[model samples]
Every structure is written in structure tokens, then in C-alpha cells.
Target: MRHAGRALACLALLSSLAVAAPAAAQDDGVAPLPDDFLWGVSSSGFQSEGNGPDSNWLRYTEEQEDKEDVGASVDFRHRYAEDIALAADMGVEVYRFGIEWARVEPAPGAWDQAELAYYDDVVRHVLDAGMTPMITLNHWVHPGWVADQGGWRSEETLRDFTAYAESIVERYAGLGVMWVTFNEPTLYVYHEIDNGAATWLDAPWLFDRLARAHSAAYDFIHEADPGAMVTSNLAFIPLTPWLFDAAFIDRIAHELDFVGIDYYMGVSLDNLTAARTLTGGLADAQPDGIYYALRYYANKFPDLPLYIVENGMATHDGAARPDGLSRAEFIEDHVYWLQRAREDGIDVIGYNYWSITDNYEWGSYTPRFGLYTVDVQGDPSLTRVPTSGVDAYAAVIADGGVPAGYDPVVPESVCSLIDPPLSCLVPAS
Candidate 1:
């Protein structure tokens, strides 16, 4: 196995020579991103924000989850400056965080100025830290009032979401923030289903509602701040991507200014172990899958710039992986493929690592996906322990991109379905 530091320097082969014969040799070298490329890290307000508010997520964590209660959740509400400083110290360009709708509008038409002011301070810190704030308007947790009004199931909820989006836009547009209407709307419905808040039959209804919400928000944001770039990022599922996501993706395609993709795991060995086994080992983290994800969207939205709004590896409770793959190696290979995709002429504008510190993952704090691990359930200090990946990411940012001709420390899987024709027809070195 290659050491993480050494992996960053290795150049085994740029690409398979035979694969690129019709075009140019893939083994030559991957090109650097434009000097102005945005490298960033992402975290969600609902997931990271602690000091429990009166929201659906707060209720879920306290009552529904079998795992640990989200006590303080690394105290991001109070410690955002430190976390932002950690990101800024890495020399990152963007910091993607959400403005919690639940927090801002705690009750029906009862806006919380304190909550809004807290976000104002957070955004200010993000800019002062020298990072562009890519603001997400929602990350799945809604006000308890909205849940009582039927969550996404209620037609009234659509108007409520748009109003909330409008309020956020009016306040923050002048701050020069990039806007995300929603984070993984498909996954939002999935979470609701998993939490027994909705059923499978409700997915289409929820999706349609989300689409309207996004469309309304897109127009609202544009009118509020002309030339605002907005998108509702999707979780890029390799399997059934078209089968499941076409309804929403197709509806919102024309409304998006950029294609925001959140890719984590992919289908491998014909089984997505991550889905079946959430024990939090890095089960199906196919770094090369990032290449196909970028390609899938690049081909689909030929003119739009693509941003990796969220991507990272997850270990079980910040434990060392049994597979022996270091976080640094995972990150390097992930970026190497992203660079390869860019070199292949994808209009890739930015990439953000999933998170800066470990926070509550939907229902569990065990699945750790962070450069700096925070033991929310254990350590009283809630120390931000640096993983090898932190250094790996820092070097990547400092250097602009990986070296030209650099090889993936992990080899591409043969016959992988992430991009079927390209996987077998156009081989990777």
C-alpha cells in the first residue's frame, strides 16, 4: 500500500494508452484547474448546529434515534469560528454552510432575529476567514411548525419554504453568497421515509413539492440579487440515477445556474455495502466514481459549470479503517480523478470536501466523514483531532491541484457501472 504522502507524489500512469487512442493519450498528464478554481469544505447547519432548537431534527434525535443523542454536536453553534479558521488555515476558497430554516423561522410567521443574527455572524466569519460562503437555504430539517402542517406532504409547506427562501435571500444577497435552494432533495425524502414521517408513495409528491420550491426560490434569489448563482444539489446515485432522479433533475435543469453534485459512495461488486452496512468503514467509496459523476453531469448539462458541493470518506466513529486505507489516500485519489475529469474537458469549477469536523450523520454520530474528527458523544472537550486527510487536503489546496501525470493510489475497478461504457470500452490506467 502506498503511504498517503507518497501517494500524492506518485505518477504510475496518467491514463490507459489504448483507451485514449481515438482521442489523445490519457497517460500524458492531467491539466491543472484554472487558477481561480474554488477548493472548499462543507457542513450543514442542522447536522452541525447544536444547543437543540425546536425543530423536526431536534425531536428526531431526542426521541426517534437509537444511537446517542446529539448533545451540542461539536458545538458548532458556538465554535464556528474555530471550524472556519481550520478551513481557512487549509487555504480553502469556499465554505459551504446552510442557513437553517428551522432556526430562522421557529414558528409559523414567527421569525427569530437571534437565529438570523447568528447566521449573519457565521457568514461574516466565513468571509473574514477569506472563504466564499456558499449558502444552503435548507438541509432537510424544517421547523416543527412545518412538520405539524404536514412537512413536505402538505401543499401549504411549499409556500412556507419559498417564503423562508425569500427571507434568506433578501438578507444575505448583498453579502455575495452563492445560494443552494436545497441540499439533496431526493435524500431529504429518503430521510423522511426512514424516519417514518413519510411513505414510498409520498416520494413523488415530495419531489414535485421540492421542485416547485426550488423553482420559486431560483426566481426569488435572481430577482433579489441579479447574477446570483443558485442550484439544488443532488446526491449522485450511480444506480437508478435516471430511474429515480429524472423527475426532479429534469424539472430543475433549466432553472439551475450550476450543477451541484454530492457524491459519496457508488455501486461496486454489484452491491452497495454502504447502504446495507452503515457500520461506517469506507465500504464503497469509489474515488474513480467521481470521474463518472462529473462526466454524467458534464455531458448532460454541457454548458453549465459543475461543483462538487460535498464529497468525503466515512470511518466508524473516527476509528482507523480495517481496510487500511488512510483518509489522506482516499482524498488524494478522489481529487486525482476529479482532476482527470477536468482535464477531459468537464466545466468543473469547484470541489468541496464533505465536512470540516465530524458531526451527527442523520441518525448516528458513528459514521465519521471529516478531516478533523470530533467525538461528540465521548470527549467532553470535543477536541478537533486532525486526521491525515487534513494535511493531504491542505497540500492539495496550496498546490492548486495534484501534480500532472499523477496516478491514483487505488486502481480503477474494472467493469464498474459508475460509467459502464467508459469503464470497459475506455479503460483507465
Candidate 2:
């Protein structure tokens, strides 16, 4: 791992030098992306699909006044066909979505064949639409029974989670579906802790349980589907350096088949940027931070393919962003960095926009991060309106990259110290 990190550092340094060359003279030529690069969008079962299920999150939203009531989240439960069509239209090659464990296993040892069948249908549709289906076994929404039995802190809950994962793999073995064992295990831990539900606080014990659950599920997924590629996606937050330490990252690095990253907000420990409140300055939320965050992980796992499993900007009540960073600009800036990361040899294989549409954002709909904004409140149409980002993303997908000569509008001085040589401006051909 140390050697891999060192190699990444050298590559970054070289790339920085390369970018300093003149932009016009640069190759600016097109290079073929990886043959298997996955271009897709992501959505969680609880967040987008509006079907009532007895899960910890359902209870959390209902009981917590501060959280948004996600009664009809874009009505994906019924509008899946339309939403999926939107993705297909965008030339997406993959669709990453989650299965609601609570809906599938309403009670202990009881399986809902119908729920499984529903997913089978969804996956089939995705395939028919010329896209692969990437499924997440758990996305922070555990069955209420497991929560009742003490959640992640309890050995019983861990056992149940593994068992559930095994069953899912067994059921969907030949579907050509990529599997994510868990979405952001660290974030899951934080959620448990924040909600006063975690069983362990210390790194050793907490990571021990996480490793146990991930390893068991990893083995089971491969056993069930010989071709399955599985991982536990991490949510990248720039502010949390301790979370990305060697101990925790190395454990995940060893377990995952690929590195799945959920990058949204950028951070700078050197500059000491405080966490912004829901309502704050938009310019302060720069996407450049994503570049460093990706570098942080790419440096650790140089050989493994990296997937931006989740990336998007949030708005308050679907309103125009106060800063110049509109939804369209946010998507464009993020994609630009994504291209830059790949150009720098990060082994990044795919980019999945955080969501297909607006849904319950864990707590509030106010933090709208959807390409197509859906009004969860008031409107009976349960309308899913295309935000400005929709057109921007459509063009990006169609072009298979950002437009030629496009540079992020951030201050050039910000990156002047470490900017890649002007010659590096050429898009990977």
C-alpha cells in the first residue's frame, strides 16, 4: 500500500507538470474510454422509490420533526418506467439502484417473492434498455427487525445482514448485476452513532464488524454469481482526514474488488473549510475538492478501478443556487474533474450521478440534488421536472465526455500552483 501511494504521488506530480504546457498546442484529441467504462445514475430504494416499508429510516423520518416526510418520493414505485426511460435517453450504460431489505424480507426468515420479482423486472428492463444493472444490498436502510435486535452493534444483526445478502445473490445470480455489499460503511457507522444506535465506537471493534459483514457478503456474492464484482462504496468528505487513515482505508482496500466513491462536497484541510450549513454560500462549495478526494483514494488503491457511485449538488427547495454554481454548472464541473482524474491515470472506470431524480434526501427534500426535480409536496401530478442539469448531463453522456475547450469557471489562481501543464488539456483520446 505504501508503494502504491508513492506511485500515485509521482504520477500526480508528473501530471501537474504536463498540464503546464500551452492549451492550444495540447493534444486536445479524443481517446477511447475504457471499453467497459460504466456511465450510469444511482438511486436508493428508500430515497426514490415511494413504497411504504417498515424500516428504521421510515420511522426516523416519521418521528423526527426536522426530517422531511418522504411520502411520495418522485413516485418511482409507479413511475420507474418513465424515469428509466429518461436514463436510457441519456445514453447511460448502467443503472445503479438499491433493494429495500425491509420490503424484501418483511419478517425474519420470510421472503417476499413478489418484491424480488419486482427487482427482476427492473433489472430486465435496464438490460433491455441496453444498460447493466448495479445493485446495492444495503443502502443504510436495514429491516426494522434488525434495528429492533440492536442494529450494527449486535452480532445477531450482522448475521442477519450476511444471510440476507447471501439470499439476494442466490436469487439474482445470473442477472449480470454488479453488487455493492454496503453503501459507505463508514457513513453507516456515523449514522448509527449520530442516531445513538452504534454498538462500538473504537476503530478496531467497529471495523472488525464491518469487515466481517463485508467479507461474508463478498464471498457469498461471488459464490452465488461467479462473475459478480462487489464493493463497499465510501462517501468521500474532504473534511474527514481521520476517517481516511491507513488502518480503515487499508482494511477496505483489501476487501473491495473495486473502489466505489460517493463524492459530493469538496474539502481542504490545509485551508480549514468548515462544514457549511444547509443554507450557506455556494461558491464556498467548490468541486475541485473532489479532485483531491479522488486522489486521496486513488493513491491508496492504484490498481483497483474507481467508480463515482454517487456525485451531485444539493439545492434548497429546488430553488436557484445563490452562488453561480447552478445545477448545470455543478454537474459540468464535477464531470470535468472526473475526466481530469481519469486523464491522470486514476483507473476511474465510471461516473454515476447521485440520483435519477429528487427523492427523500435522508432528511429533507430541501436539499434537492436531482437532475429532474420532483415536488414531493403539494402537486398531485407528483411531477418530475427536468432541471437545467438534465440537458447538461444529456450532452455529456452523448459526447462521452465534456465539451471541447470547456474549463471550469473557478479562479485560475486557485490551481495555478499545481495546475497540470497546458499540454495535458487534451482530452484522453
Q: Report per-prediction Cα RMSD to one decimal.
A: 7.0, 4.7
lDDT, residue 154, candidate 2: 75
lDDT of each candidate versus the true structure: 0.81, 0.72
Compose the digit string of candidate 1's lDDT tens values, residues 1-429. Answer: 224432232122124332221234366676667788899999998788777677777788878748567778888899999999999999998999988888888888889999899999999999998888999988988988888888999999999998888988999887778999989888889888888789999989999999999999999888988878999898887744654457587789999999999988766554356564564355656787787777767756777899999998888876676556788998888888877776677778999998999998877888888899988887999899999989999998887777787777767766556644444344444
165, model 2: CA deviation in Å? 0.5
| Runs in model 2 lying further than 4 Å from the true structure | 1-35, 199-204, 239-242, 245-248, 268-274, 278-283, 412-429
Give the residue spans of candidate 1 off by over 4 A: 1-28, 268-281
TM-scores of all predicted structures: 0.91, 0.86
RMSD of 1: 7.0
lDDT of 1: 0.81
Best by lDDT: 1
Model 2 is weakest, by summed lDDT over 10 consecutive residues, at 416-425
- Best prediction by TM-score: 1
Tens-place lDDT per residue, model 2, 350-391, is 889978888887887777778888878867797878888888
